[model samples]
Target: MAEKASESSNSISLNTVDGKIFKVSPTIANQMQTIQSLIKAYDSSRVISLPHVNAFHLSKIIEYLEGKSATTVSAVKEFEAQFMKDLSLKQLKGLLIAVGYLKVNELLELMPKTVAKLIENKSVEFLRKFFGIVNDFTPSEEAKIREEIAWAFDGVDED
Candidate 1:
Protein backbone atom coordinates (compact mmCIF):
# COMPACT_ATOMS: atom_id res chain seq x y z
CA MET A 1 0.00 0.00 0.00
CA ALA A 2 2.77 2.39 0.93
CA GLU A 3 4.63 1.45 -2.25
CA LYS A 4 1.54 2.18 -4.33
CA ALA A 5 1.20 5.58 -2.71
CA SER A 6 4.87 6.32 -3.31
CA GLU A 7 4.63 5.29 -6.94
CA SER A 8 1.66 7.55 -7.50
CA SER A 9 3.61 10.44 -6.02
CA ASN A 10 6.79 9.89 -8.01
CA SER A 11 7.99 12.18 -10.79
CA ILE A 12 6.58 11.53 -14.25
CA SER A 13 8.81 9.89 -16.83
CA LEU A 14 8.54 11.07 -20.42
CA ASN A 15 10.03 9.25 -23.39
CA THR A 16 10.76 11.47 -26.35
CA VAL A 17 10.55 10.38 -29.98
CA ASP A 18 14.32 10.13 -30.15
CA GLY A 19 14.23 7.67 -27.22
CA LYS A 20 15.57 10.02 -24.56
CA ILE A 21 13.87 9.77 -21.17
CA PHE A 22 13.16 12.82 -19.05
CA LYS A 23 11.93 12.90 -15.49
CA VAL A 24 9.77 15.89 -14.60
CA SER A 25 8.03 16.91 -11.44
CA PRO A 26 4.25 16.88 -11.44
CA THR A 27 4.22 20.64 -11.36
CA ILE A 28 6.18 20.79 -14.59
CA ALA A 29 4.23 17.98 -16.23
CA ASN A 30 0.93 19.63 -15.45
CA GLN A 31 2.00 22.71 -17.37
CA MET A 32 1.94 20.67 -20.55
CA GLN A 33 -1.75 19.97 -21.14
CA THR A 34 -1.11 16.93 -23.33
CA ILE A 35 1.11 15.34 -20.73
CA GLN A 36 -1.25 16.37 -17.99
CA SER A 37 -4.11 14.53 -19.67
CA LEU A 38 -1.92 11.51 -20.25
CA ILE A 39 -0.91 11.47 -16.61
CA LYS A 40 -4.56 11.56 -15.58
CA ALA A 41 -5.51 8.77 -17.98
CA TYR A 42 -2.72 6.34 -17.09
CA ASP A 43 -0.72 5.28 -14.07
CA SER A 44 1.71 8.06 -13.21
CA SER A 45 4.53 5.55 -12.79
CA ARG A 46 4.26 4.55 -16.40
CA VAL A 47 6.46 6.39 -18.85
CA ILE A 48 4.56 8.69 -21.18
CA SER A 49 5.66 8.38 -24.79
CA LEU A 50 5.69 11.45 -26.97
CA PRO A 51 5.84 10.29 -30.57
CA HIS A 52 5.80 13.81 -32.04
CA VAL A 53 8.36 15.41 -29.73
CA ASN A 54 12.09 14.89 -30.22
CA ALA A 55 14.69 15.13 -27.44
CA PHE A 56 15.90 18.60 -28.39
CA HIS A 57 12.42 20.07 -28.46
CA LEU A 58 11.42 18.30 -25.26
CA SER A 59 14.56 19.55 -23.56
CA LYS A 60 13.85 23.10 -24.67
CA ILE A 61 10.27 22.89 -23.33
CA ILE A 62 11.54 21.57 -20.01
CA GLU A 63 14.16 24.28 -19.89
CA TYR A 64 11.50 26.93 -20.49
CA LEU A 65 9.31 25.52 -17.74
CA GLU A 66 12.17 25.41 -15.23
CA GLY A 67 13.67 28.74 -16.22
CA LYS A 68 10.41 30.70 -16.07
CA SER A 69 9.80 29.86 -12.40
CA ALA A 70 12.18 32.62 -11.32
CA THR A 71 11.29 34.95 -8.47
CA THR A 72 10.97 37.97 -10.70
CA VAL A 73 8.84 38.54 -13.78
CA SER A 74 11.60 40.62 -15.37
CA ALA A 75 14.05 37.78 -15.01
CA VAL A 76 11.64 35.37 -16.64
CA LYS A 77 11.04 37.79 -19.50
CA GLU A 78 14.78 38.11 -20.03
CA PHE A 79 15.17 34.37 -19.98
CA GLU A 80 12.36 33.89 -22.49
CA ALA A 81 13.95 36.41 -24.84
CA GLN A 82 17.29 34.65 -24.73
CA PHE A 83 15.61 31.29 -25.19
CA MET A 84 13.83 32.40 -28.37
CA LYS A 85 16.90 34.15 -29.70
CA ASP A 86 19.06 31.09 -29.25
CA LEU A 87 16.93 28.95 -31.61
CA SER A 88 17.70 29.00 -35.32
CA LEU A 89 14.81 29.28 -37.82
CA LYS A 90 14.71 25.50 -38.25
CA GLN A 91 14.83 24.97 -34.51
CA LEU A 92 12.16 27.57 -33.95
CA LYS A 93 9.78 25.87 -36.40
CA GLY A 94 10.36 22.44 -34.87
CA LEU A 95 9.95 23.77 -31.33
CA LEU A 96 6.79 25.60 -32.26
CA ILE A 97 5.28 22.41 -33.69
CA ALA A 98 6.25 20.47 -30.59
CA VAL A 99 4.90 23.18 -28.30
CA GLY A 100 1.63 23.12 -30.22
CA TYR A 101 1.34 19.35 -29.95
CA LEU A 102 2.14 19.41 -26.23
CA LYS A 103 -0.22 22.31 -25.69
CA VAL A 104 2.34 24.30 -23.73
CA ASN A 105 0.24 27.43 -23.37
CA GLU A 106 2.95 29.95 -22.51
CA LEU A 107 5.18 28.84 -25.36
CA LEU A 108 2.24 28.68 -27.78
CA GLU A 109 1.67 32.35 -27.07
CA LEU A 110 5.30 33.38 -27.13
CA MET A 111 6.57 31.50 -30.18
CA PRO A 112 3.95 32.76 -32.67
CA LYS A 113 4.67 36.33 -31.59
CA THR A 114 8.37 35.72 -32.01
CA VAL A 115 7.74 34.35 -35.51
CA ALA A 116 5.55 37.32 -36.35
CA LYS A 117 8.23 39.72 -35.21
CA LEU A 118 10.82 37.93 -37.34
CA ILE A 119 8.78 38.30 -40.54
CA GLU A 120 7.29 41.69 -39.78
CA ASN A 121 8.06 44.43 -42.32
CA LYS A 122 9.74 41.89 -44.61
CA SER A 123 8.86 41.62 -48.29
CA VAL A 124 6.99 38.73 -49.92
CA GLU A 125 10.13 37.49 -51.63
CA PHE A 126 11.98 37.54 -48.32
CA LEU A 127 9.15 35.70 -46.61
CA ARG A 128 9.07 33.06 -49.34
CA LYS A 129 12.80 32.54 -49.01
CA PHE A 130 12.60 32.59 -45.22
CA PHE A 131 9.97 29.87 -45.20
CA GLY A 132 11.44 27.96 -48.13
CA ILE A 133 8.23 28.36 -50.12
CA VAL A 134 8.72 27.85 -53.82
CA ASN A 135 6.98 30.36 -56.04
CA ASP A 136 4.87 28.34 -58.46
CA PHE A 137 3.18 31.09 -60.42
CA THR A 138 4.49 32.03 -63.86
CA PRO A 139 5.49 35.64 -64.51
CA SER A 140 2.15 36.76 -65.98
CA GLU A 141 0.11 34.99 -63.28
CA GLU A 142 2.36 36.59 -60.63
CA ALA A 143 1.91 40.01 -62.20
CA LYS A 144 -1.87 39.70 -62.11
CA ILE A 145 -1.93 38.70 -58.45
CA ARG A 146 0.46 41.51 -57.56
CA GLU A 147 -1.66 44.05 -59.46
CA GLU A 148 -4.80 42.90 -57.68
CA ILE A 149 -3.16 43.06 -54.27
CA ALA A 150 -0.99 46.10 -54.76
CA TRP A 151 -2.13 47.62 -51.45
CA ALA A 152 -0.51 44.76 -49.49
CA PHE A 153 2.80 45.47 -51.12
CA ASP A 154 2.63 49.23 -50.50
CA GLY A 155 4.74 49.35 -47.33
CA VAL A 156 6.62 46.05 -47.71
CA ASP A 157 10.31 46.33 -46.92
CA GLU A 158 12.78 45.64 -49.70
CA ASP A 159 13.92 42.03 -49.97
Candidate 2:
Protein backbone atom coordinates (compact mmCIF):
# COMPACT_ATOMS: atom_id res chain seq x y z
CA MET A 1 0.00 0.00 0.00
CA ALA A 2 1.17 3.55 -0.65
CA GLU A 3 0.46 4.42 2.98
CA LYS A 4 2.65 1.60 4.16
CA ALA A 5 5.37 2.63 1.74
CA SER A 6 5.23 6.20 2.99
CA GLU A 7 5.24 5.04 6.62
CA SER A 8 8.34 2.95 5.98
CA SER A 9 10.23 5.85 4.48
CA ASN A 10 12.80 7.13 6.98
CA SER A 11 14.01 10.38 5.54
CA ILE A 12 13.56 13.54 7.62
CA SER A 13 14.59 17.06 6.73
CA LEU A 14 16.07 19.29 9.45
CA ASN A 15 16.37 22.98 8.79
CA THR A 16 18.97 24.78 10.85
CA VAL A 17 18.74 28.31 12.16
CA ASP A 18 21.00 29.56 9.39
CA GLY A 19 18.80 27.91 6.74
CA LYS A 20 21.13 24.99 6.09
CA ILE A 21 19.16 21.80 5.51
CA PHE A 22 20.17 18.26 6.39
CA LYS A 23 18.34 15.19 5.20
CA VAL A 24 18.77 12.41 7.76
CA SER A 25 17.44 8.95 8.36
CA PRO A 26 15.01 8.12 11.15
CA THR A 27 17.74 6.34 13.07
CA ILE A 28 19.92 9.43 13.00
CA ALA A 29 17.06 11.87 13.63
CA ASN A 30 15.80 9.73 16.52
CA GLN A 31 19.10 10.27 18.25
CA MET A 32 18.00 13.85 18.86
CA GLN A 33 15.11 14.11 21.34
CA THR A 34 13.99 17.44 19.98
CA ILE A 35 13.90 16.21 16.41
CA GLN A 36 12.28 12.94 17.42
CA SER A 37 9.52 14.83 19.20
CA LEU A 38 9.08 17.10 16.23
CA ILE A 39 8.81 14.12 13.88
CA LYS A 40 6.27 12.50 16.15
CA ALA A 41 4.22 15.69 16.34
CA TYR A 42 4.32 16.40 12.61
CA ASP A 43 4.82 14.75 9.25
CA SER A 44 8.28 13.31 8.56
CA SER A 45 8.27 15.11 5.19
CA ARG A 46 7.93 18.44 6.93
CA VAL A 47 11.13 20.46 7.28
CA ILE A 48 11.64 20.70 11.06
CA SER A 49 13.12 24.04 11.87
CA LEU A 50 15.63 24.22 14.70
CA PRO A 51 15.84 27.86 15.65
CA HIS A 52 18.65 27.45 18.18
CA VAL A 53 21.02 25.01 16.50
CA ASN A 54 23.41 26.05 13.75
CA ALA A 55 24.35 24.00 10.69
CA PHE A 56 27.88 23.29 11.86
CA HIS A 57 26.78 21.91 15.21
CA LEU A 58 23.84 20.05 13.71
CA SER A 59 26.11 18.47 11.12
CA LYS A 60 28.56 17.40 13.79
CA ILE A 61 25.75 15.98 15.90
CA ILE A 62 24.47 14.07 12.89
CA GLU A 63 27.97 12.79 12.22
CA TYR A 64 28.15 11.60 15.81
CA LEU A 65 24.76 9.92 15.60
CA GLU A 66 25.68 8.19 12.35
CA GLY A 67 28.94 6.94 13.80
CA LYS A 68 27.39 5.72 17.06
CA SER A 69 25.75 2.72 15.43
CA ALA A 70 29.10 1.15 14.50
CA THR A 71 29.23 -2.63 14.67
CA THR A 72 32.09 -2.69 17.15
CA VAL A 73 32.37 -0.91 20.47
CA SER A 74 36.03 -0.12 19.86
CA ALA A 75 35.18 1.46 16.53
CA VAL A 76 32.59 3.69 18.16
CA LYS A 77 34.99 4.63 20.92
CA GLU A 78 37.71 5.49 18.43
CA PHE A 79 35.34 7.57 16.37
CA GLU A 80 34.08 9.41 19.43
CA ALA A 81 37.59 10.10 20.66
CA GLN A 82 38.66 11.42 17.30
CA PHE A 83 35.53 13.52 17.06
CA MET A 84 36.24 15.17 20.41
CA LYS A 85 39.89 15.63 19.54
CA ASP A 86 39.01 17.38 16.29
CA LEU A 87 36.98 20.09 18.01
CA SER A 88 38.42 23.23 19.58
CA LEU A 89 37.22 24.46 22.97
CA LYS A 90 34.96 27.02 21.32
CA GLN A 91 33.59 24.43 18.94
CA LEU A 92 33.14 22.00 21.79
CA LYS A 93 31.15 24.57 23.76
CA GLY A 94 28.95 25.24 20.78
CA LEU A 95 28.44 21.54 20.23
CA LEU A 96 27.66 21.07 23.91
CA ILE A 97 24.99 23.72 23.78
CA ALA A 98 23.49 22.16 20.70
CA VAL A 99 23.65 18.68 22.17
CA GLY A 100 22.05 19.90 25.36
CA TYR A 101 19.29 21.55 23.41
CA LEU A 102 18.76 18.45 21.32
CA LYS A 103 18.87 16.28 24.46
CA VAL A 104 21.54 13.93 23.15
CA ASN A 105 22.30 12.18 26.43
CA GLU A 106 25.40 10.30 25.29
CA LEU A 107 27.01 13.39 23.80
CA LEU A 108 25.98 15.57 26.75
CA GLU A 109 27.77 13.18 29.11
CA LEU A 110 30.75 12.53 26.85
CA MET A 111 31.46 16.16 25.99
CA PRO A 112 31.36 17.49 29.56
CA LYS A 113 33.47 14.59 30.81
CA THR A 114 36.01 15.24 28.05
CA VAL A 115 36.11 18.94 28.87
CA ALA A 116 36.45 18.17 32.56
CA LYS A 117 39.39 15.87 31.86
CA LEU A 118 41.02 18.59 29.80
CA ILE A 119 40.62 21.06 32.64
CA GLU A 120 41.47 18.58 35.36
CA ASN A 121 44.58 19.46 37.38
CA LYS A 122 44.80 22.78 35.55
CA SER A 123 45.44 26.02 37.48
CA VAL A 124 42.95 28.86 37.83
CA GLU A 125 45.00 30.99 35.48
CA PHE A 126 45.12 28.14 32.99
CA LEU A 127 41.35 27.68 33.25
CA ARG A 128 40.80 31.40 32.84
CA LYS A 129 42.97 31.43 29.73
CA PHE A 130 41.51 28.23 28.28
CA PHE A 131 37.92 29.39 28.82
CA GLY A 132 38.67 33.03 27.98
CA ILE A 133 37.10 34.15 31.25
CA VAL A 134 38.03 37.48 32.71
CA ASN A 135 38.92 37.55 36.40
CA ASP A 136 36.73 40.29 37.78
CA PHE A 137 37.87 39.92 41.39
CA THR A 138 40.28 42.48 42.86
CA PRO A 139 43.65 41.28 44.16
CA SER A 140 42.51 41.17 47.79
CA GLU A 141 39.32 39.34 46.91
CA GLU A 142 41.21 36.87 44.74
CA ALA A 143 43.80 36.29 47.44
CA LYS A 144 41.06 35.60 50.00
CA ILE A 145 39.30 33.16 47.72
CA ARG A 146 42.60 31.49 46.84
CA GLU A 147 43.52 31.21 50.51
CA GLU A 148 40.12 29.64 51.26
CA ILE A 149 40.63 27.00 48.60
CA ALA A 150 44.40 26.69 48.80
CA TRP A 151 44.22 22.89 48.83
CA ALA A 152 42.76 22.92 45.30
CA PHE A 153 46.01 24.36 43.99
CA ASP A 154 48.18 21.73 45.61
CA GLY A 155 49.20 18.63 43.59
CA VAL A 156 48.08 20.28 40.36
CA ASP A 157 49.60 18.80 37.24
CA GLU A 158 52.31 20.79 35.50
CA ASP A 159 51.14 22.60 32.38
Candidate 3:
Protein backbone atom coordinates (compact mmCIF):
# COMPACT_ATOMS: atom_id res chain seq x y z
CA MET A 1 0.00 0.00 0.00
CA ALA A 2 2.80 2.38 0.83
CA GLU A 3 4.47 1.65 -2.48
CA LYS A 4 1.23 2.38 -4.29
CA ALA A 5 0.68 5.54 -2.31
CA SER A 6 4.19 6.74 -3.05
CA GLU A 7 3.67 6.05 -6.72
CA SER A 8 0.74 8.43 -6.94
CA SER A 9 2.21 11.22 -4.84
CA ASN A 10 5.17 12.81 -6.56
CA SER A 11 4.07 11.48 -9.93
CA ILE A 12 0.96 10.11 -11.46
CA SER A 13 2.47 7.01 -12.94
CA LEU A 14 0.94 5.98 -16.23
CA ASN A 15 1.13 2.31 -17.14
CA THR A 16 1.41 2.30 -20.88
CA VAL A 17 0.49 -0.68 -22.99
CA ASP A 18 4.12 -1.43 -23.86
CA GLY A 19 4.70 -2.31 -20.18
CA LYS A 20 6.40 0.97 -19.53
CA ILE A 21 5.74 3.44 -16.72
CA PHE A 22 5.67 7.15 -17.40
CA LYS A 23 6.18 9.13 -14.24
CA VAL A 24 5.28 12.75 -14.69
CA SER A 25 4.96 15.66 -12.30
CA PRO A 26 1.48 16.24 -10.95
CA THR A 27 1.39 19.56 -12.74
CA ILE A 28 2.38 18.04 -16.01
CA ALA A 29 0.01 15.15 -15.42
CA ASN A 30 -2.79 17.62 -14.90
CA GLN A 31 -2.24 18.96 -18.39
CA MET A 32 -3.76 15.67 -19.53
CA GLN A 33 -7.45 15.56 -18.68
CA THR A 34 -7.49 11.79 -18.25
CA ILE A 35 -4.50 11.86 -15.92
CA GLN A 36 -5.64 15.03 -14.21
CA SER A 37 -9.04 13.61 -13.36
CA LEU A 38 -7.50 10.34 -12.25
CA ILE A 39 -5.09 12.03 -9.88
CA LYS A 40 -7.71 14.38 -8.58
CA ALA A 41 -10.12 11.65 -7.56
CA TYR A 42 -7.91 8.66 -7.07
CA ASP A 43 -7.15 7.18 -3.68
CA SER A 44 -3.49 7.97 -4.31
CA SER A 45 -2.83 4.31 -3.70
CA ARG A 46 -3.32 3.18 -7.23
CA VAL A 47 -1.38 3.80 -10.39
CA ILE A 48 -3.27 5.83 -12.93
CA SER A 49 -2.92 3.19 -15.52
CA LEU A 50 -3.46 4.13 -19.17
CA PRO A 51 -3.88 0.79 -20.85
CA HIS A 52 -4.68 2.33 -24.20
CA VAL A 53 -1.70 4.66 -24.55
CA ASN A 54 1.42 2.85 -25.58
CA ALA A 55 4.79 4.08 -24.33
CA PHE A 56 5.69 5.86 -27.56
CA HIS A 57 2.51 7.92 -27.59
CA LEU A 58 2.73 8.54 -23.87
CA SER A 59 6.29 9.79 -24.24
CA LYS A 60 5.29 12.29 -26.89
CA ILE A 61 2.32 13.51 -24.85
CA ILE A 62 4.48 14.00 -21.82
CA GLU A 63 7.07 15.87 -23.83
CA TYR A 64 4.45 18.21 -25.19
CA LEU A 65 2.92 18.80 -21.79
CA GLU A 66 6.30 19.47 -20.21
CA GLY A 67 7.36 21.84 -22.95
CA LYS A 68 4.07 23.72 -22.93
CA SER A 69 4.13 23.97 -19.18
CA ALA A 70 7.61 25.46 -19.17
CA THR A 71 7.10 27.99 -21.91
CA THR A 72 5.87 31.46 -21.23
CA VAL A 73 2.57 32.55 -22.76
CA SER A 74 4.36 35.27 -24.70
CA ALA A 75 6.64 32.72 -26.30
CA VAL A 76 4.00 30.04 -26.77
CA LYS A 77 3.05 31.29 -30.22
CA GLU A 78 6.61 30.93 -31.48
CA PHE A 79 7.02 27.62 -29.68
CA GLU A 80 3.76 26.44 -31.19
CA ALA A 81 5.01 27.15 -34.70
CA GLN A 82 8.27 25.29 -34.11
CA PHE A 83 6.57 22.39 -32.35
CA MET A 84 4.25 21.63 -35.27
CA LYS A 85 7.14 22.00 -37.69
CA ASP A 86 8.98 19.12 -36.05
CA LEU A 87 6.28 16.51 -36.63
CA SER A 88 5.53 14.68 -39.83
CA LEU A 89 1.93 14.40 -41.00
CA LYS A 90 1.65 10.89 -39.57
CA GLN A 91 3.12 11.94 -36.26
CA LEU A 92 0.90 15.00 -36.23
CA LYS A 93 -2.18 12.89 -36.81
CA GLY A 94 -1.23 10.50 -34.05
CA LEU A 95 -0.41 13.38 -31.76
CA LEU A 96 -3.79 14.89 -32.62
CA ILE A 97 -5.60 11.80 -31.38
CA ALA A 98 -3.43 11.55 -28.29
CA VAL A 99 -3.69 15.21 -27.37
CA GLY A 100 -7.44 15.14 -27.96
CA TYR A 101 -7.73 12.13 -25.66
CA LEU A 102 -5.73 14.00 -23.06
CA LYS A 103 -7.73 17.20 -23.69
CA VAL A 104 -4.59 19.29 -23.77
CA ASN A 105 -6.13 22.59 -24.82
CA GLU A 106 -3.04 24.24 -26.25
CA LEU A 107 -2.15 21.21 -28.28
CA LEU A 108 -5.72 20.81 -29.38
CA GLU A 109 -5.75 24.41 -30.53
CA LEU A 110 -2.36 24.33 -32.19
CA MET A 111 -2.86 21.03 -33.99
CA PRO A 112 -6.07 22.02 -35.72
CA LYS A 113 -4.59 25.34 -36.70
CA THR A 114 -1.64 23.57 -38.26
CA VAL A 115 -3.94 21.15 -40.06
CA ALA A 116 -6.09 24.04 -41.21
CA LYS A 117 -3.07 25.83 -42.57
CA LEU A 118 -1.99 22.71 -44.41
CA ILE A 119 -5.39 22.31 -46.02
CA GLU A 120 -6.17 25.96 -46.57
CA ASN A 121 -4.76 25.99 -50.08
CA LYS A 122 -4.43 22.26 -50.71
CA SER A 123 -5.99 20.43 -53.60
CA VAL A 124 -8.85 18.02 -52.98
CA GLU A 125 -6.49 15.17 -53.78
CA PHE A 126 -3.81 16.64 -51.57
CA LEU A 127 -6.13 17.02 -48.59
CA ARG A 128 -7.61 13.60 -49.01
CA LYS A 129 -4.20 12.00 -49.42
CA PHE A 130 -2.70 13.89 -46.52
CA PHE A 131 -5.43 12.84 -44.11
CA GLY A 132 -5.96 9.40 -45.63
CA ILE A 133 -9.64 10.24 -45.77
CA VAL A 134 -11.45 8.64 -48.63
CA ASN A 135 -13.93 10.62 -50.63
CA ASP A 136 -16.80 8.43 -49.57
CA PHE A 137 -19.50 10.64 -50.99
CA THR A 138 -20.93 10.01 -54.43
CA PRO A 139 -19.60 12.31 -57.11
CA SER A 140 -22.61 14.62 -56.80
CA GLU A 141 -22.27 14.83 -53.02
CA GLU A 142 -18.57 15.46 -53.33
CA ALA A 143 -19.16 18.21 -55.82
CA LYS A 144 -21.76 19.81 -53.56
CA ILE A 145 -19.40 20.10 -50.64
CA ARG A 146 -16.72 21.49 -52.87
CA GLU A 147 -19.07 23.99 -54.43
CA GLU A 148 -20.18 25.12 -51.01
CA ILE A 149 -16.59 26.14 -50.39
CA ALA A 150 -15.80 27.01 -53.99
CA TRP A 151 -13.41 29.77 -53.03
CA ALA A 152 -11.07 27.09 -51.66
CA PHE A 153 -10.47 25.69 -55.14
CA ASP A 154 -9.44 29.01 -56.61
CA GLY A 155 -5.71 28.53 -56.87
CA VAL A 156 -3.75 25.35 -57.68
CA ASP A 157 -0.94 23.96 -59.82
CA GLU A 158 -3.20 21.46 -61.64
CA ASP A 159 -3.70 24.20 -64.21
Candidate 4:
Protein backbone atom coordinates (compact mmCIF):
# COMPACT_ATOMS: atom_id res chain seq x y z
CA MET A 1 0.00 0.00 0.00
CA ALA A 2 1.03 3.65 -0.46
CA GLU A 3 1.12 4.21 3.30
CA LYS A 4 3.41 1.26 3.85
CA ALA A 5 5.71 2.47 1.09
CA SER A 6 6.02 5.88 2.76
CA GLU A 7 6.68 4.30 6.13
CA SER A 8 9.44 2.17 4.65
CA SER A 9 11.22 5.03 2.92
CA ASN A 10 15.01 4.87 2.85
CA SER A 11 15.71 8.16 4.62
CA ILE A 12 14.02 11.01 6.47
CA SER A 13 15.03 14.63 6.03
CA LEU A 14 15.67 16.83 9.05
CA ASN A 15 15.75 20.60 8.80
CA THR A 16 17.85 22.30 11.44
CA VAL A 17 17.32 25.72 13.01
CA ASP A 18 20.29 27.05 11.05
CA GLY A 19 18.67 26.06 7.77
CA LYS A 20 20.79 23.01 7.13
CA ILE A 21 18.99 19.84 6.01
CA PHE A 22 20.19 16.35 6.83
CA LYS A 23 18.84 13.08 5.49
CA VAL A 24 19.11 10.25 8.00
CA SER A 25 18.00 6.64 8.09
CA PRO A 26 15.06 5.64 10.27
CA THR A 27 17.38 3.91 12.70
CA ILE A 28 19.28 7.13 13.35
CA ALA A 29 16.19 9.33 13.39
CA ASN A 30 14.41 7.04 15.79
CA GLN A 31 17.31 7.16 18.20
CA MET A 32 16.25 10.74 18.90
CA GLN A 33 12.92 10.23 20.66
CA THR A 34 11.61 13.64 19.69
CA ILE A 35 12.25 12.92 16.04
CA GLN A 36 10.79 9.46 16.42
CA SER A 37 7.59 11.01 17.78
CA LEU A 38 7.54 13.51 14.95
CA ILE A 39 7.98 10.72 12.43
CA LYS A 40 5.00 8.94 13.94
CA ALA A 41 2.83 12.06 14.02
CA TYR A 42 3.69 13.37 10.56
CA ASP A 43 4.46 11.84 7.23
CA SER A 44 7.98 10.38 7.37
CA SER A 45 8.57 11.35 3.75
CA ARG A 46 8.48 15.06 4.58
CA VAL A 47 11.28 17.04 6.14
CA ILE A 48 11.05 17.34 9.92
CA SER A 49 11.96 20.79 11.19
CA LEU A 50 13.87 21.04 14.44
CA PRO A 51 13.24 24.56 15.67
CA HIS A 52 15.47 24.31 18.76
CA VAL A 53 18.42 22.31 17.42
CA ASN A 54 21.12 24.05 15.46
CA ALA A 55 23.10 22.61 12.56
CA PHE A 56 26.28 22.01 14.57
CA HIS A 57 24.49 20.16 17.35
CA LEU A 58 22.41 18.11 14.92
CA SER A 59 25.53 17.12 12.98
CA LYS A 60 27.32 16.15 16.19
CA ILE A 61 24.36 14.01 17.26
CA ILE A 62 24.34 12.29 13.88
CA GLU A 63 28.08 11.72 14.05
CA TYR A 64 27.76 10.20 17.51
CA LEU A 65 24.96 7.89 16.40
CA GLU A 66 26.88 6.67 13.37
CA GLY A 67 30.19 6.29 15.17
CA LYS A 68 28.79 4.28 18.05
CA SER A 69 27.41 1.66 15.72
CA ALA A 70 29.54 -0.94 13.83
CA THR A 71 32.20 -1.01 16.51
CA THR A 72 33.30 -3.39 19.24
CA VAL A 73 32.24 -2.58 22.81
CA SER A 74 35.75 -1.51 23.82
CA ALA A 75 36.13 0.50 20.66
CA VAL A 76 32.79 2.17 21.31
CA LYS A 77 33.96 3.16 24.79
CA GLU A 78 37.11 4.65 23.31
CA PHE A 79 35.07 6.42 20.66
CA GLU A 80 32.73 7.89 23.26
CA ALA A 81 35.64 9.08 25.36
CA GLN A 82 37.32 10.69 22.38
CA PHE A 83 34.05 12.16 21.23
CA MET A 84 33.43 13.84 24.59
CA LYS A 85 37.04 14.94 24.86
CA ASP A 86 36.98 16.62 21.47
CA LEU A 87 34.19 18.96 22.53
CA SER A 88 35.00 22.25 24.20
CA LEU A 89 33.11 23.16 27.37
CA LYS A 90 30.77 25.39 25.36
CA GLN A 91 30.14 22.70 22.81
CA LEU A 92 29.53 20.13 25.51
CA LYS A 93 26.94 22.34 27.16
CA GLY A 94 25.24 23.12 23.88
CA LEU A 95 25.24 19.50 22.81
CA LEU A 96 23.87 18.44 26.17
CA ILE A 97 20.96 20.85 25.74
CA ALA A 98 20.27 19.58 22.26
CA VAL A 99 20.51 15.98 23.44
CA GLY A 100 18.06 16.71 26.24
CA TYR A 101 15.64 18.39 23.88
CA LEU A 102 15.83 15.47 21.50
CA LYS A 103 15.54 13.01 24.39
CA VAL A 104 18.47 10.93 23.18
CA ASN A 105 18.44 8.34 25.94
CA GLU A 106 22.09 7.33 25.60
CA LEU A 107 23.31 10.92 25.79
CA LEU A 108 20.81 11.76 28.52
CA GLU A 109 22.64 9.18 30.60
CA LEU A 110 26.18 9.96 29.48
CA MET A 111 26.35 13.76 29.45
CA PRO A 112 25.22 14.34 33.04
CA LYS A 113 27.75 11.76 34.23
CA THR A 114 30.44 13.50 32.23
CA VAL A 115 29.48 16.87 33.68
CA ALA A 116 29.45 15.39 37.17
CA LYS A 117 32.93 14.01 36.62
CA LEU A 118 34.08 17.42 35.45
CA ILE A 119 32.86 19.06 38.67
CA GLU A 120 33.57 16.32 41.16
CA ASN A 121 35.90 17.28 44.01
CA LYS A 122 36.09 20.84 42.72
CA SER A 123 35.78 23.82 45.10
CA VAL A 124 32.66 25.94 45.36
CA GLU A 125 34.55 28.83 43.81
CA PHE A 126 35.77 26.65 40.97
CA LEU A 127 32.26 25.32 40.43
CA ARG A 128 30.82 28.81 40.42
CA LYS A 129 33.38 29.87 37.83
CA PHE A 130 32.88 26.75 35.75
CA PHE A 131 29.11 27.28 35.60
CA GLY A 132 29.29 31.08 35.32
CA ILE A 133 27.27 31.47 38.51
CA VAL A 134 27.62 34.76 40.26
CA ASN A 135 28.27 34.81 43.99
CA ASP A 136 25.01 36.33 45.15
CA PHE A 137 25.62 35.99 48.88
CA THR A 138 27.20 38.83 50.80
CA PRO A 139 30.61 38.14 52.38
CA SER A 140 29.07 37.80 55.84
CA GLU A 141 26.30 35.48 54.61
CA GLU A 142 28.83 33.36 52.77
CA ALA A 143 31.05 33.24 55.87
CA LYS A 144 28.08 32.19 58.02
CA ILE A 145 27.13 29.39 55.61
CA ARG A 146 30.73 28.23 55.40
CA GLU A 147 31.12 28.29 59.15
CA GLU A 148 27.93 26.30 59.60
CA ILE A 149 29.03 23.67 57.10
CA ALA A 150 32.74 23.69 57.85
CA TRP A 151 32.79 19.90 57.83
CA ALA A 152 31.55 19.89 54.22
CA PHE A 153 34.64 21.78 53.05
CA ASP A 154 37.20 19.50 54.69
CA GLY A 155 39.68 18.09 52.13
CA VAL A 156 37.87 19.80 49.27
CA ASP A 157 40.14 20.17 46.28
CA GLU A 158 41.79 23.56 45.84
CA ASP A 159 40.39 25.78 43.08
Stretches off by above 4 angstroms in model 3 are 1-8, 132-134, 144-152, 157-159
Sorting all predicted structures by lDDT, with the top scorer first, yields: 1, 4, 2, 3
Provide the lDDT at 113 for model 2: 83
lDDT of 3 by residue, 70-132 (tens): 789998777777878988878887777777777877677778988988767677787777767
The TM-score that candidate 4 achieves is 0.80
Cα lDDT of all candidates, in order?
0.86, 0.82, 0.73, 0.85
Q: Where does candidate 1 clash, by residue pair?
A: none
lDDT of 2 by residue, 51-138 (tens): 9899899888877876777547878878889999999988988888899999987798789889999888888888887767899999
* Cα lDDT for residue 7, candidate 2: 39
Q: Which of the two candidates, 1 or 4, achieves a greater TM-score against the reference?
A: 1
lDDT of 4 at 102: 94
- Name the 10 consecutive residues with the lowest summed lDDT in model 4: 1-10
Clash-forming residue pairs, model 4:
none
Error of 2 at 111 (Å): 1.2
Winning candidate number (TM-score): 1
Cα lDDT of candidate 4 equals 0.85
Better of 1 and 3 by TM-score: 1
